[model samples]
Target: MAAGQVDELRKRVNDDWERIVELLKQKIALGSVSSKGIAADHMKRSAQFVADELIKVGVDAKVVQSTNPDGSAGAWEVIGSKIVNEQAPTVLLYAHHDVQPVPDASQWDTDPFVGTEIDGRLYGRGSADDGGGIAIHSGALQALGDDLPVNIKVFIEGEEEMGSPSFIPFIESHREEFDSDVIIVADSGNWSADIPSLTTSLRGNTTLDVTVSVLGHPVHSGQFGGPILDANTLAAMLISSLYDEHGDVIVPGVASQEVVGGLQRDLDEASVRADAAVEPTYTMAGTGSLAERLWTKPSITVIGMDVHPVEGSFNVIANQTRIRLSMRTAPGQKPQEAQQALAKYLVENAPFGAKVEVTPLDNGMGWAMDPDAEATQDALQAMKEAFGVDPVNKGEGGSIPFIPELQRIFPQAQVLVTGPEDPKANAHSPNESISLSGLRNNVIAEALLLSKLGGE
Candidate 1:
């Protein structure tokens, strides 16, 4: 915990940069998508890979298997522990090893599964989403060597990207194994490439699959174009009705909350356009500050649709259309409440007397924590000391469904969400990457956090 010790730890992490990249590349090459059969096997290997790395740092590590909610084999969960002092407070470090499937490799600048470094940034599918997280934990522990200050528990999950279908049962079945005083989720993003951030809140999510039927079978467009309504057209109208001209959700019962005053980053029109790849001439939608719309309000997106391809020149009226709807709720909104509101709107607003059926797909609750808590103060101080700048408190628009669950399981534990992702990281998208400097700073901050929380 001395200045020289901190300097040495930073030096060690910097020296091991290549090794960290190699380990990340190895995991990226495994293709651990839970939906694929081979992904299960790859995930097991990924878990063991983490365990082995932890063991190299003198930690007791092992791979544990559990069943998915549907009674199928689930991805392996790795648990590594280093008990420097049993009396010290336990620190749990959390990260996921699984990567999302490459939807279309053609869209990427490089192979999505191959970790590539260009201009000091490592790029790949999982390179930033969580592969960086895995490396951060390993790098921090490795830097500590035999001088680790606290009882450390490292948890690497394999099914986070897949919505953690097995997480509830897995945690319930092994509650004691994950007991800790503080939990740090290394799966969020920094405010920017140079500005570190601590995520204070995460939005919850709900999804619905809707099917609309207007006719018994396909009919010639010319014969029934005016008199008979097509399911596809009706589906389009129904989806459009979910939003008003301002691009805000029109559902009546969904909730919204005001973000507390703080040093929030202003997401301007230019930044939004660049980040979203929007057309330069397009005008921004919604009726609030960009930050308010993005971080403190409900948003709806049409994720997928099942309809005839336009390339085939289908002039026939389709009998049915299926659509997938994904909605992100405000922090204080419950997923169930949002789901019901969405379902009610879709059902009541169906056009052309179409027969509609709405099926609930999944739901994840939002999470919020006090930024001034004792552990959070320690984290902020550590980050400031390590990065030489004040860390910003931010709210994530995306959902980490299991975070609230972890809070519920360990009500007394302080949750700290921090990571290496920046706006340009583009996690779960093509050309995902991470800044090497950011990774190094993350390792330093985490190491210092562990030391400080250990009462050093």
Candidate 2:
């Protein structure tokens, strides 16, 4: 395709940006929080709204009730497809309609459901995490009209915020419709607002529950505290053994690798601290550049621990305590292997002869995109043209967990991880938002990519 064709696609997107934002705002207002706590009917409303909007743009769309793990009905997901020609390549565009629960509405500057535009950012629960991705797909389809270069398949899951429990079954049931040459997952963010990114790698996750038993029965802290420690204290010691003084995962068996791209120079230590809201008084943990620490290194956190409530304090030390460890493995590492290693480490490192039991929770594999894939190159060129800057190769410290499933089902398809998010998007947090320019450019980029794939 000629550069002029891409320019025309950009122009078309710019013209449709306002309408796209309005539709996105309406979708955001539906407040499709995931089924973790919100009602299923609420998610269905958002799914149905997206289906209606896509149908209006001439795409065949529908709201589907996902099948739960136990064969029960689950949350609603939307799947839509528009095929121009069988000979043309098929591209599956993926997003999520669900938003994280607004556990505390008081933390938000604006209503979580109402899209509030301020200084070029649209702030709301789903605005950046995925509402913007939906807008890009809808706007691109509208701009392309009947002149599409490739078949478009849209997959919007309603439970991504909760780790997409039913994602594999949902896509497996509709395998034929989703059989595509490429997948554009719009769930990640860019390196920065000025630099567009194609996320090439994501860390995998595995969980382990460590329980410590220091005594057969409760003991008086005042009498036995000098010679014996409580299970809670022993549990803390076991957790601390997983990390070094510098907060690095020092476990011998867990592996780490250097990323394809070195540290992202666009982000400095200060910027990262700011993004994570780390206090200035605290020191950045681990070693290497910020990108390496985040993207390639393994990290372990004691997400939860069971202990006696401070308000209901007891003079006696508890016999047993449990702590949940959530570990993020590097891309290309086997999560099961790491989990085993973690289990062994906790058992060996138990302090004061405390009996330790490690139980496996779950292991979700990570994804590493092939940068040399044709679809990937097409996306990079499209993003460069649309954003007027060279695109960056990015890695996500967080794991999608479901992307690998998509690959397992369609081994030949190239996955292009693209999104409209930036550092300040604040996805899953209070005041979540997406930059308007970023959203507009993302729409243009997708249109450009489709044109490239279709050889327009």
Best by lDDT: 2
Off by over 4 Å in 2: 36-39, 104-106, 261-266, 310-318
- Write the residue-wise lDDT of candidate 2 on 375-431 in tens digits: 888888988988899988778888888898899899999988888789898887899
User: What TM-score does candidate 1 get on C-alpha atoms?
Assistant: 0.85
Measured over all alpha carbons after superposition, the RMSD of each candidate to the real structure, in angstroms, is 3.5, 2.3
Q: Predict model 1's lDDT versus the native.
A: 0.84
Clashing pairs in 2: none
TM-score of each: 0.85, 0.92
Q: Candidate 1 lDDT, tens digit per residue, 230-281? A: 8988998998887898888788999887663354566667887887899877
- Model 2 weakest lDDT span, ten residues long: 259-268
How far residue 257's Cα lies from its native spot in candidate 2, in Å, is 1.3
In model 1, the Cα lDDT at residue 67 comes to: 87
**Which runs of model 1 end up more than 4 angstroms from their true locations?**
1-9, 15-22, 25-41, 101-116, 210-238, 260-263, 305-322, 348-357
